[model samples]
Target: MSGTGRQLAVTADEVVDAELVDEGAALSPAPADPGATPAVHTDRDRHLSPETVAAIEESVADSTRRAYSADREAFAAWCATEGRVPVPASGETMAEWVGYLTVTPRKRTGKPAGPSTIERAMSAVTSWHEEQGHPKPNMRGARKVLNAYKDRLAEAKAEAARARQATAALPSQIRAMLIGTDRSTLAGMRNAALVLLGFATAARVSELVALDLAAVEETEHGYDVTLYRKKVRKHTTNAILYGTDPATCPVRALRAYLAALEAAGRTEGPLFVRVDRWDRIAPPLTRRNKDTGIVEPIGDPAGRMTAEAAAEVVERLAVAAGLSGDWSGHSLRRGFATAARAAGHDPLEIARAGGWVDGSRVLARYMDDVDRVKNSPLVGIGL
Candidate 1:
């Protein structure tokens, strides 16, 4: 629902005044009845119009609301499976949900729900109940279940946290990997550009794989990469990214890959594509010669790459460079944030580059983790 330049003077606690409402009939709609009557009783007159409800919903940021919606949907599905009510959830239902989330592996990461994740889920459920005008679910039992799980996790907090996160591909390790890569090979050139660009842009695997040939524009300073992703509003320009070293430069690596593809008659389409075991982006596009009825190799257009494929590049390159720990595409992003934080760069700059929302907990955690070891006064002193 939208309003036509109507103003509602709202403060932290209550609505102060409503403007441009004198000439209109107050359309108080409800979720149960979208076409609710504007009729008012003497005793009960507090009703929100659809527009007002929408405005209220917008109080929460769109991203957070999206997460809450997903969590609410997941909880509803679980409730259906367990033969229980989701909205007006009882204490026992909430307890079981907490236990289930603790043990159940997530679809994306294949790990048990973290404490933060569980907490978010609970918040989503509470929001749902409140929206339905029901009392909050008694979560005393749920809190006990969560407390027990947290107690076990507290035993090795550092180890558990580290184990769950993708290992940061630090600058030193990146230099090693870049130096170790053989640029002579097509795969080598592609892999080098993939990792370096991933690091430089702090791009997610999905965003990296979604690039097209036209997305990148070469300039004298460096490349201006225009990325369009959901995390990014419209498109983002990662401009003037320069590397000090020749061997580790993303621009040079990308140029080499583009040159190789052009030689094979591929100058357009997907920026990153599947490179087969035989070191081929694709067999040249073949067509039958109608006159002679003979098929021949034509242009070399390539297939698109997947997010998984992008991640494997990071893991494979890290392994080849003899760097230890579990590396994934996220390593690039995490590494960039950590390194920038360590170098005393502004938090907003790091967050903007990584497409992290303002006041992100994960971003704070990454910086805090770096601060911890160096914080002690005994660190520099050989104790």
Candidate 2:
């Protein structure tokens, strides 16, 4: 088989042809018999219609499809470089790919990919084969390789317990971050609302960016934010109550942010928007400056913030507050769970508050450090 040096950008018909050739099915027409009548149709002639194929493709989420495509392409590139067939790849070949990913220096960082990254790439390879009607690659060898890699890390005392690991913002840390936010500008107000509301709801960055003004209902106390979709559940809404302190209140901060948007005549679309370098919200297409006599360029009001942007927000805040540790989008959600557990709340309550559907065990991971100290057997004993 010839390597294309990259994934073959073939159409659906080409894919079908390739599969047929791979299966050794006859593509030529049978010899015509002038004397014979046309044979009756049978079940063997039945096949999926175009509509069915389209529906099948659309069933998977767009993000998942994109990830699978990218992963497959990367694997194909690797296979080309190694003189291996990506499609119908052997178990041995898959294992070799795993090893390569583990040790190969990345172009940008010059560091080998991590275990999780390797696993995800492997999964992508498996998914592509399955989609093309090929037998799934026997991953036993790959699994063994990963297990051995992990064992080495454990021997070196580098493997941390998954449950005991989390980068969370403490209350004081959050307060300092809030104080450091310059709320006089549009960007500052948006960032403040983003961080505050993110912490209060324990929402994932994806969820935070997915919020829309239409889904927000003002309540007597604070506000009710409706999430149309989440990783765990399809749809759910959470109530954010007003805080006693105005400066630290997520509800109050959100209200102020909304007021700013309203003043800009933005009453619809995404709750959070992108602010330009000049600290101004991009005006809508229909908006015009009456005094300047110039039409302001329209921006995407319905655009959702990317996860990278959200992580940058957390990192910026952490640095501004002089707090250390690799802070990311997960800090807000993890921080809420950690802080709640430290406040002596029940595990179940914390789980519910954080939208954890897998029970207390999932929530327990965030509070491992707190649990170690609070539930320690030697708490009363002198060191």
lDDT of 2 by residue, 283-352 (tens): 4444678999787654454545566677688889889888877688788988988888899998787776
Instruction: Return the top candidate by lDDT.
Output: 1
Candidate 1 minimal-lDDT segment of 10 residues: 1-10
Q: For candidate 1, what is the TM-score?
A: 0.68
Candidate 2 Cα errors over 4 Å, as ranges: 1-67, 154-166, 284-304, 359-364, 381-383
Q: Which candidate is the best by TM-score?
A: 2
Candidate 1: how large is its RMSD? 9.9
* CA lDDT of every candidate: 0.77, 0.74
Q: List TM-scores for all candidates, in order.
A: 0.68, 0.75
Give the backbone clash total of model 1.
0
Model 1, range 251-304, lDDT digits (tens) per residue? 887888888878767778888877778888855467999999999766334577
Residue pairs that clash (backbone atoms under 3 angstroms), model 2: none
